[model samples]
Target: MKLPLSADPPAFEIRYGITEEAARRKGYEIRKRTAPPDPSPLDALLKKMSPEAVKKWGETLGGPGGKEAPNVSVTMPNGDEVGAPTTGCDAEARTALWGSVEHWLLGQRFGSDFREGLISRAEKDPAMRALNVEWSQCMAAKSFADLESPAKAMDLAASFYEKGDETTAFTREVDLAIADAQCENDTDYVRKRRILEDRYLAAGMGGYETEIAATRELNRGALVRARTLLAS
Candidate 1:
């Protein structure tokens, strides 16, 4: 796919944008939201409460919404229903419970095996479908790491490096997709997909090596810059 911006653009285009007001409004909203020191209802209540009252009743004496406390749903800027604190649970403890429940539920349908069960279940449910997307992403990353062939690796890097960035699986799941694509084919009376495929037949490749390399390069540069600054 072609990139959005041209290799070069006019200087005037850089200074002016189509929606100056909209951009300004977005910036203002971000500032306003960030200005609050702590924006939870619990935090607000504690701050407004009298020092005497705080001393008498210590933090978290169990408010009106105990175990059955209403879900502390918050309206994010976007209309999505992200996690809000449910009633009767501390943010950390209570929130952690949900993950356990989700896992147990998943295990019932799928199994303990991560991708095997996840992919199987995801085939049936929309929520599981999202999980499958994650599964694919992970498997892809795993695939790229064990990459054996420079030719195939070059192709993967080419496909995802289409959108250049610092890490493995840069713009797409090229590695994982490539592995999945070749997995079935490779299983039967094998033909070597790459020149180096046989050398590291045991080691195998993963998908996100590009991103990982990019990240390592960035970190190495940062380390050098930091060390230089410290020495100076």
Candidate 2:
């Protein structure tokens, strides 16, 4: 069947490295702040004892008799459940501290829904329906007759998560995905759908331009903040 109009990699996928780098930096900061230092056993023992008794006992024993212990738990800033001292900082606190960077990363990935809507509109066109019929026949010839649309195939791919060994399921998904791509290419389904989608998008360029421009500016502002944070 015909592939969805937005099956190609997203525009933001090109800049995804920025999100990866920022996430790593954020994780480092959280770990640095929340992972408590290890404590000596003597200090740990002494804190549980009264100071006077410990001091008197230390003299009797010929040395300080206690060591510091690691903290048991850390209360996060957002008042969520306390995290173990060995864990990373609070998720809410990290978001608050680096909100601008996160916002930009999200803005870069906002157009998928818009593209999907365009695809839906394109599918309603008489020409697209005929192309879809051809695409279905092509898929049937390849022994995937049960799949009526690329979206349905995608859903089937996702269904692999429900059961079976994960690696085996993933291998099955790879095979299906490759077949889907090849079938779409062979049938020229992708090319025809792309032409229709472009025409639809061009027909309503005004609203699209405004939405895209706003999203672009949001990403630009966020990227600037993310760069500053990383440099610091």
Candidate 3:
């Protein structure tokens, strides 16, 4: 699928930064969600324990001098560190955690922006931002001073439309001009033409010839025949 940022350029940079930041921020982000770790191992260990553990073995990483923290204490189901807070976590861990959280919240705040960045990096780079800037400019257009006649102006757009080219330019004007001339010879009322053959031109015997075909062989034809005879 073509992503919005595909055609734009700088969008990829934004994408990379956002992803890196989000990943780096995750450790801090997780800390924000969970309860703070206790400095005292006993307290920290106790907090992580299931209710059943405090009762079965009491609260201790290990009883007495064997006080080494259990493997489970340091690692979680997914193998990521569990107890350390963003504040106390090592630099790398802190970077990842903090990045992870910030990018997540950023996604929520500016959803489309965040998603576009991800897409730009994943799909097309270099073109995303450039195209976005161009689009932003187009959308901001404020004036119609450059407008052209509707029928003639859309030349470049002809390919996209199904209409043929001849009727594309000034056709409406030509049609309208001829229509205006014809309308001058016609009227709205039919007072004379209303009755079988009111005052409107009539054939006299048969229903007045209203059709061009019937009148073509009448006086009109006689005039043409006479002109031909004169010429001969």
TM-score-sorted candidate list, best first: 2, 1, 3
Candidate 2 segments whose C-alpha is farther than 4 A from its true place: 1-109, 141-143, 154-186
Question: How would you order the candidates by lDDT, starting with the best?
Answer: 2, 1, 3
Best by TM-score: 2
Residue pairs clashing in model 2 are 42-66, 42-67, 43-66, 43-67, 43-68, 44-67, 44-68
Tens digits of per-residue lDDT for model 2 on 1-232? 1111111224421100112233323311222323578888976887788867666554443322223312223221122222211112222323334353233223534455455556567779998778777767776777778776666655676676578886666666556555666666676776677788798767655556865776677756656765777899
lDDT of each: 0.34, 0.51, 0.30
Off by more than 4 A, model 3: 1-117, 120-124, 143-232
Q: What is the lDDT of candidate 1?
A: 0.34
Per-residue alpha-carbon lDDT of candidate 3 for residues 1-232, written as tens digits (9 for 90 to 100): 1111111112322111112233333311222323465489766776787776664443221221222522211321122332321221232332343243222222222323333333324223234333333323332342212322111112222322244553342343233223222221232112211331221123222332342233333434445554766788
Q: Which wins on TM-score, candidate 1 or candidate 2?
A: 2
In candidate 2, how many clashes are counted? 7
Q: Give residue 118's lDDT in candidate 2 (0 to 100).
A: 61
